[model samples]
Target: MELLAGARIALTPRPVERRHAALEVAMLGHCPGRVRLERLLQLPAALADMRAVGYGQAVDAFSSGAASELYNLPIPLQSSAEFHDIFPDALTATTEYVSLLAGNKAWLGLAVDDFFANGGEKLWVVRIPESAGQAGFLPADATQLHDITTLQGLACVLVIPALGVVGFPDLERLQIPPRLPDIPRVRLENFEPQFLPCTQNTEDDHRERRYSSELSDMPPPWQLPQVLRGMLQYVSSHRPDLQCLFTLPLAYSGELDSPVLDPTALSALSGYQQLPDRAQALRHVQFLFPYLRGPRFALHTPVGLIAGQQAAVARRDGPWRSMAAKPLNTDALPYPRLSIAQTLGLRDKPGISVLNYRNSFSGGAQLSLDDERLVVPALPVADYPVDRQRYDGFCSAEVMRFLGFLRRQLQALGEQLIFNLDYRDPRPRLLLEQFFRRLYSQGALRGASAEQAFSIRESTPQEGAMLYEIMLAPAFPIDRLFLTFANLNGEWRSEVVDG
Candidate 1:
């Protein structure tokens, strides 16, 4: 008889591992022409000189690299202090070329500074090339919109498995002029002439130069809703683990007091109708309002500040902690200040979050996040109730982040065991259960006991894949509080009431 062939064993080595930090953020925007001078210098001598001179002279020169490129900036090492040294095109008081081409105001630079100042540790900057035209600000044409909706515009960011949040600072810049307001003329009619140390050949004289006014016109307000919808959908479908933090475009004529009433307002509560109906898409998007003004910078969107806060909160506590009602550690103040009634109105809106001032015990007013809300739809009535088992967990940003964290952790575990484990192996299941128990011990899950906190079970396998169903009871933040005050027996007393 022929000898039986020994069983063949094909060993599959595990793939290379990549680690991701929690709550990392990616910012996509336009950079000044000085940022690309290094790459231009690598060209032929004649071509390099021509492009450099031409770029300096042009207002909308193509300085950014391909849309797929990402510039990683680690905290402290490559912080704002080293920003100019790293990217020569960065806006500096002495960089005349940047002032001429970019109006001496780079939103990207300000955003980067705000991010680092607010406790952000890791950042990825995606520069939108000038070739994108209006799309570099907000998608204007069909081709531009296609790039965003298809996820090609943010391909570099999306490829990073660890990216937790993303924002488009330049997107809101489309609502305002690129240049800052001109210095107001002062009247010296009533002032008495005084001798001062003045020299006709002062060094400051060489710094004064007229900036270009050929900046691009502000895009129409209607384009905002369309662009936002595309972004929401892109993040939802391609990377559900990520959150898109956005700043609503400012009102065209007046203050953003009543965002729900204006259909043109991108942050309008009613504007959700223009977005995709999928709950997944809506939950992945968040909007902040009114912009902010600080001593170091002019009026700018609060996306950078909020993104930094999210990272800081996630690192200090857990991603499940709510960022609302917490004092921001920045000196920036909200612009077009809203009255108490207006602030309450904004707080009541289900989609938008507002930044407002609160009186602290130290006798000073502090800027704080009023609420943390997602772009989810309103709950349905009991009669025509849809399955909300999944939807309910995503209504809060805190819950959404917790779920994303679990997804990342589970994904990493699976990757590590892909080639080493068998479908029938019990070790993987034990590891998963232990992993959840560890989370429960860490206060991520809420329950009187382990059984109530979470439940894990193997699901029916499909094809060649093993599956598991994990039901989790994540701890939620206290969003509302009730007080009972009554006058009893000639005494006034107040007690906490349960909802």
Candidate 2:
């Protein structure tokens, strides 16, 4: 743990300012250098250091609603002859490789690339002609997606993780992509938004790091191959012996949020009884999960849970993941992975999430504190992580909604929670962040001069602000739990906030 000696420090402005915020001078008197400092990064070499501590790659997350396509290497969604007409030359090359995967394979692959200090390769170049309102899209089943940047340059090859595939040109062939013309002069005016540099690692004092974990307690069966690939990336890039993800089950206090029950909810709970349709209730949900090497956890998704279908990522044989369960008690200290506070601090997220769990923070935070559940509302996007004791202004929408719901479900329950109208939109970082924030704000503007600090970057804006409202749910008990997750929507929204 590298301790900070003073209060303030200065560093250069990141080529990319908004997300990869490396302040010209950072205040670091209290926080240690080795802890939060590792959270920021200016170079790919940082990948090794992160792996050493405990970070993993997130791939193919877009279709799953977790990751987005913008960050993925460009790969065709389909390889059928029918789809080829719309594929770009690069995607065409990528498909050729995926086709080699034995099945009806698709992949992200690259043909020509080379970029270093003087220049970098174009990260994306999709030239699919527009059709009758349809995108040149492919399905998640596609096996391969080309990372053009990784294949084109020696710099990419030099900075690869230990295991996993990195397809560079057959160097013995003595061939490389043509470099862009020399730069005679430089000016801010020449910048084009689409042509912004890829968000790459930088050489800054404040490092920008990323962390990932399986969204659900169990891994989806369909995610096996991708899980294997991710595992390879983790095994090759990181030394998990020193650091890795610490996963609590669906019941663990780490992953879920906890809130007191309202009177109505208490009433409902007292007389709670199930009809016992095990098959229907268990339809597409998983019961257990296995930790496939890497940051992934395998799960047996039921068939009935997929978007349109009732069933989803079910293992071919039977059970999908390989995990058993045990209850979590106070003996468990900091979670297997970063705690909620640590996660918010590291990610620079203004608020926190509890996904769907509403009882994670039921335990007493203090040794002698009352057993009341702690609930706090999510913060606005602008607010950073702070000491819980110091936060009196923030409210936990999740808790209010949960307790409000229990008020109706459970009878005579007493649960108090605050709600906030403010929340920072977690639109996709690269593009969507700007788009939605722009839509909601009176006159938000991307600096006509704003550009990526690194070479590889993707920005995505969500439709929540435009199409629907999105809010964060951070619920802590007044005395017990600190953070919880649950979205008050549909009937719940009407019952909790609207009412």
Q: Pick the TM-score winner.
A: 1
RMSD to the hidden true structure, all candidates: 13.5, 29.2
lDDT of 2 by residue, 1-499 (tens): 1224463553322232122111000000010011121222222333333333222342223223452222222221111121122222322221111110011111111111111110111111122211201112211223222332232121112122221112211110011011111112233353354543578643442321211221112211112222223322322223111101111121112223321111232222122212122111111111111111111111111100110010010111111111111111111122122344543332122222211111335663311100101122223223534344355323322132222222222221111111222223333233334433432232111222223211223233563232322232222223213343456663322222211
Candidate models: Cα lDDT each: 0.59, 0.21
TM per candidate comes to 0.72, 0.16
lDDT of 1 by residue, 1-499 (tens): 0123463552222212223345778787666555533333232332332233222222123333333232221111124444434454544433111222123355666777777677776676666664454355332224332232333345545655667888877656544433333233344455475665766433443332454454334334335656666675546666778777776654323333222223355344455534335443566767677677777655566887787888878888878787787677778888646677776665555556788888988898998887787656222222113444344334567766777777778887999998999877889999988998888887888899988999988965686678889888777555557998999999999999532
Residue pairs of candidate 1 with colliding backbone atoms: 34-89, 35-89
Off by over 4 Å in 2: 1-88, 97-494, 497-499
Q: Which candidate is the best by lDDT?
A: 1
